[model samples]
Target: MAISLAALRQMILAHPKALAQGLSLLVLAAAYSPVSVLNLSPVYGSAATKLFHRYGMAVTAILGWFLKERIHEMSRGRIARLLPVLAVSIAAIQFLLFKLSSWLGSPFGPVITESFTYYPLLALSIAASAKLIQYATEISRYGETIAEHGPLIASYVVFNLAERISEAFISKVIGSTFLLTRYGLQLVIAALYAITIPSKSLVLTIPLLLLSYTSNVHVPTKHTTAVLNERIQPYGFELIDRRDSLTGYISVLDNLNEGYRVMRADHSLLGGEWTKLPGQYNPKVKDPIYAVFTMLEAVRLVETEPPRPADQDSKALVIGLGIGTTPGSLISHGIDTTIVEIDPVVYYFANKYFHLPHNHTAVIQDAEKFVKKSLASPTSPRYDYIVHDVFTGGAEPINLFTIEFLQQLSDLLKDNGVIAINFAGDLSLYPAGLVVRTIKHVFPSCRIFREDAAMENHPAVDFTNMVVFCTKAAGTPIRFRNPVPADFLGSKARETYLMPKHEIDASAFETIEKGGQRLLKAASVDHIAAFQDRSAIGHWKIMRTVLPDAVWENW
Candidate 1:
């Protein structure tokens, strides 16, 4: 009692209403799939999701209306003739929306399908254009020979459903696979299309699949922890800790020969000396720059009179703690210090492995939120020294560098307070220049210094660290001090670090105009995020040499 192929075909053909309903379901599913899948990730936030959802629904409604109008007016033969053209148009529009969404920095934006409203508008246009072209073609080709109203609507519905199902399946599979290999997904899409289309040749797809798999094959590399443990163990350096954070890697290495050294490998430092064991060897002079960190140490040399024993119970606020280097030194100096670090992993690894000062307070929160909360409370204690060193690898949190942010920081500082801000970047770039200019707009008196002196003043060098020392007082100046034996934690390594002789080249800051129209302030969180993607890309390139490409790829 096996059902014959002929019988099954006749049943499918005869039940036109059932076939239409099935196709309609497929079409609706395909149209809504992108938004459905996109919602699974929390990265886009509520504003973006709302925009996508609204537009997606609108597009579906418009398309539904157009399809209904076509069903009512067109004959079965005429409708059948239009299905292929409609399918191709739908595919083209979906791809276009994807491209446009990417270009606008979001899947939901003011243009294209970036907003919830815009997406449906674009989808409706696609559906209506597809339906109209299909209708015109059928009339031009078959004319009076076409059936006025039979099962043509059912056939068109089935084809439309198939196209949508194909779209959803293709988009999801490609999207999921793209996290592994972008080109591999492209090959997979081609193969899927080859298998689905009746007349298309599958021979070419076989070779492409083979080639893509070969190219994208993942081969594990040597573990970085093992390499670090083996190479620096003889130097009396023990690999005590390592942890990865959303921001970067925070590690702690202890040297039996000296004392513990806190290291922050921020996936952005290139050719720079890492303070811990497995330290970088013979780093190119142009490559290693620590000017910002050195400037942070310059807080010790502020021209204010030495604090009396009565005022010795001073508190310090460090906004961005990287491996707790400056704050570690501050705590060692007997100053009560509190560090506000956004990433908990950074704090955990820095303390466990980097041997950061254990006595200090650790507040894990976004600096902006913390600052706002602190400012709102007038009873908040003022900090004697505020070190704003938040630069991580290639990206600086733009909001942290804004004039409004600096103003809030200034309000939180004592009248005679000293602040050292570590700004790392290529000074030649517009972004860096803009940041420097913005800082100058807020602070009354400031002096900028490069972490390392430029041998020949080549501005084109891609990497460098700079520090800007700012004071609320109009005439305050900062000077560097030699590290004393007491400054070191009973380790000779302090001799090199205590009196770090990095010279300040103030000419670059002088060249930047103050209060100029070009000094744009980063006022919102959105502004800060706009730079993250590009900054991450730049940071990735710089970090490749410090840690092997395989390490980052694994993450």
Candidate 2:
């Protein structure tokens, strides 16, 4: 039942508008793909939402409308057949150019990189889409007339759906190696145009498609780790393992010179620890590279209303498992612990590489959903200590910081239970204040402590990690009892950072009675998300200082 070439050509000619509509969808998807890829890089990862999504959409719409006449003219000539091939070629080139992020250092590199990647891709895709729409309009004029903007409106709907569909497809279906899926889609679009349009360009398109297949898709998939390691080896870093998970691009990177390993999710470092490799600074236990994780363990030391039960008799819940540093410490202390991590890959890597203890319950689910369900159940257990440390990618997960979510966490805690929340941001920003204010609104008595001392000559907008400790019961001030030798667990990091110091005055974040700052809820969380550009940029600078440009760029 294979259709002959003549019959296929007749079918396409009879339904040019349908072919045009389908090709436009493919072109729109290609346009949105680079934004996701750019987010995987350190240079553009922080500001990508604003840089590409909000502004990229506006640019696409304006360019699509403006290019209509030019595209219509092109559609009448030889160039129309080449537009699809050119569009697909640009998408392949954009992915290749993204590897040049190391060469394009920041201050203005992201601007240049975006110019090369998203802007050109947008123009080419829009031109191709407009040409298709022109074909649709011409076809409709010979039949039942479409509305003046019917095809244009339909293309816009396709554009909007492209973003959401790609997101779901990448996260749910493709998982790892989504870059390959993107490029493959581009190739399919090119082939579709060659088949339907009937052009001599097929001579160039077939070979070019094969070349892209071997060079971009095939070779990279076969030797991705080897290629990545070769690029980053000069900086004493090694790509241990990486996967595109439901959360983001998760990687385990090792700093050979420093003898430490870090788990990364896109542009942010989740957690890391010193290794016991030869010639390295050996310790009794693998010490945490970041002191903030150790500081999270201070949840246990907080004195309760009546008084917290002994470690053996207490139960704990950890909302986020970042290398299982805090939860491992809690398990070692004999606290019955339950970890609720949204990404199973994080939990798996924590166990495989970071040696997370297996004694605790692992609820691999969203923290908010877990909280909601637990609160609904009559048999829901109350935790003596709950650790909420879900901050990542230069901004906290906005949903986790909402007043409603905080109240649920409060409900899940025993009457005297203590919750330690980790937040990373500049203190001067309104978003930071909004989060702190919301926490205080939920918990009447709370205290804040920075992981380290404020640096000398640091910028006014200091970006650092801080933990907020609060209690379910009010009136009594939240205080930490002195840690004894047992609390150290033989690790030097815990010995030093277990006691929270550098207390930030909780009252400092307090909004004035009429300052207009209010608690974050599900509806208003976007306010915090929208203002994270500065904070994320600040964090990007900090991460660059932590690891070399080559390490981030290669990934």
Candidate 3:
């Protein structure tokens, strides 16, 4: 430890500017890793997500100032003499790094994730690494050669680069608000590796490294879809399809023996449909294999809420389009459905893989943004049924769940309208309690039902999915018509479970100490987030049970 510190001190003193540049690379890696995926208290998560740009830029500037002298010294060089020489040297080093990295990480040249923007950084990093090494060599004691330290330098660059690159690919890069932040984090690291060091050990380490990485390598190809399927084969499943979008990682997975085709968004399963197609397994009904998906369809069953319009005459709005189960059902039944989904990839995947209806209007935008616009327009159309099925990545959209957003949803509804809000969380947690209280406040006469009525026997299973059915009328009864086989579209599964009376009723649980039972306005939603962290972790474990661990890890 003492030798390490002394060596670090000597290296910093000798080539502080190079270390500063490398620090930027380290920061880029950290920001893009699982470190950014933390589930914080509602208030902290909101502040951190929204203000990341301001803080990230500030950090970059601070790193620059710390390494300012090396930049200043580089500027002092003889440009006329060094210009061509440095450019040639940088190009040569970059070509070498690309071959080595591509062989180890990508099959082609460096995996050009975004055109050639990041490729140039490879040249820049190599040049910087070379200059930094030259500076260190010049400062060393007269008898020692820089080659003596080549092994150590290679270890540093390769280890850090490998960690950052793997994580940036495996973990979602969601720290920055701007699209620019999504650009090559690995490119910066590659750049620093180019600029700071180009040692023989980097080239020599590939043989042992090649084995662990073979099946999971990602490089864009015309056969990119084929590559994803090949990658998941080792995990005992086939990746039927996958997409990287602004919101999160979305995948459609199928295992014939498991008898289901599941849609996954990061760690959470959006929903699943039974694999029994018309001929192969040949089941009598088109029933969903997952009960939670059917629970979302129950809003259509609210009988006492309104009387006038038929399914064709009434309109329905869906907030989050998870595999389009509810909206597709609405559209099929001849309801004029409009879906507001934030992620375009999700909308696309739902249409392609989950059989989402294309006949209705699709608004590929955030629910918050869409709601704000709808509220602004004087002639905005009202919805007879609004489905608030926005659960994703183990949590509901925080902004949309706020009392303010819920009230706007109320405004968008017709006077006799009914709403179904699907939320997943521990029944014992403040988030679940607060959400229930808030819905009751917004809709007056609402009843909550658990997705699995059978789950009531297990007190250990606190984290579960529930749908709240609410009506606009305060004093009116919010009841469901007994679903006949026709109402279920001939699916016995839906007829049996869609409108089950099993409630995760607020009255059943003990009162939370010190008002965890309190209603959450937009301002108080932060407190709910603080409590929701454990629930999210619980969700992560629950999701693992739904699929194998290897599948989630590879994804």
Candidate 4:
């Protein structure tokens, strides 16, 4: 301890300049943090963040040169021999490890999502480049060019700023496609660097670099996964189709074991249906794999306490079509169902795979825009039933859930019309209560129901789907009659889950706590983002539990 104290004293008393330089380097390093570029946009490519680090190192190296710090460089012979040897050795090790793991059935290979050595390697390269400039280029006499590195320095600074600002940016795609493109391009650059160092190879290398850039210019994606050895051979659930949409990752997985197919938005199962023919179909089981899908059908059962109209006579407007579960049932019952789905891919897949009824009105547009337009038009038909079932991955379309939107729906609803909103949240969080409160505020007569009667594991907030049945007729009690055989539409799954059993008493959750009165308006939509994060994490965990790790991981 005394020796350490003496060393510290010496540094503070005598070696202050050295201490300042060391601290400055640390500060520079500390500035280079993992900036989350997950704004859910592909504007910035996967390689962009990696490039930012390189730019930063180059800037720092140029700065060091301007500061008259003597840098270190290796000759062409050293660069050629050392780099190829290093690259080859790493490749050989990785290949051998893969072989060993395959034979021994042991977990091997890089588990890290990305390499930690990436930035360090960039720093080393930049330092070496600066040193090369110092020795070979006669840079000591060319003092004026030091200022010319300003643009490079500015580029580095801009990258850091961009990374910091783009925390919420996420890519729409997260799979092998982006990974292959990103790293493949990077490897080519590395190869070119090794060859380009010698003057003779420039004739060959420049053309190759140009060809590589021209052929493989990266268009960004949301994320990329590290290549894993575990091949994703999903049992029964065959990937019939998949799409990367603005809303989320949509996939249609066919259950080979059950002869059913489901559409998924991100980690949440939107809806599913039985695909087997008459004799092949098991009428009693797995028709609507999830109870929530069938529960959505119960919106048909809401023939008001004030009794507006029966399902056959009702004009139903569905804001979100999740594999057409609710609308399909409505169409089956002869209701004039108009579905508003944002993603064309979802609508296409729904009809092609889930057997969605072709007779109903399909409005392929944003729910808000459609709603606004419908409200504006004097000749627009009012709806007897408006189903706001726009939920996925523990989060709802916040805009659809807003009071302003609900009020707009109210404007579009026929007198005494019913609306069923599907919300997935943890009952323990204030956000859930807030949402319920907002629903109640918009629709005076309403009843909430948990999708399933199953109890939650968490004492505080167990995330689950809950449907709120609201009516245009204020002060009228929300009453639902038991769905008879006719309402089942020859689907026994509807017969089983048409009535939501675990009805939540509004007395407990009707009032939100502090900052609870923040009723969802169009402007302040980001209020639910915090809640969404928690819910999304829970949903991800739940999905992992539902499917094998390899199934989700391989994507």
Cα RMSD, each candidate: 13.4, 5.4, 11.8, 11.5
The runs of at least 3 residues in candidate 4 whose Cα sits more than 4 Å from the true structure, single-residue gaps closed, are: 1-234, 276-286, 310-312, 454-461, 515-518
lDDT of 3 by residue, 3-54 (tens): 3566656766776665554444333333333222221111022122222322
Q: Please name the candidate that would achieve the greatest TM-score relative to the true structure.
A: 2
Segments in model 3 whose C-alpha atoms lie over 4 Å from true places: 1-188, 196-201, 205-213, 217-236, 278-285, 454-458, 515-517
lDDT of 2 by residue, 382-491 (tens): 99999998866566777888899999888888998999999888876787788888999899889999888877786866888889999867688887889898888877
Q: Name the top lDDT candidate.
A: 2
Candidate 2 accuracy as lDDT: 0.71
lDDT of 1 at 530: 33
What is the lDDT for 494 in model 3? Answer: 71
Candidate 4's residue-wise lDDT over 1-555, tens digit each? 122565435434554443333233222232322311111111111122233444445554455444333333334324322332232122223222322321322011121111222233334333443333334333233345543463235334644564454322222232235432322323433454445343333344454434433332122222211112113333545565665555555667766766777787654677777776578445322367777767777776776655667667879898888888778777877889899998777898888887787999999898889999998888899998888878754466677777898889999887877788888767777677877888888888888888766465645447788888888677778777777877676667777788888988887776667775547777787776666656655555556566654444333
lDDT of 1 by residue, 478-548 (tens): 54545555555443334344453555555454454443334556544353343344444444444544443
Candidate lDDT scores, in order, read 0.50, 0.71, 0.59, 0.57
Assess every candidate by TM-score: 0.53, 0.86, 0.68, 0.66
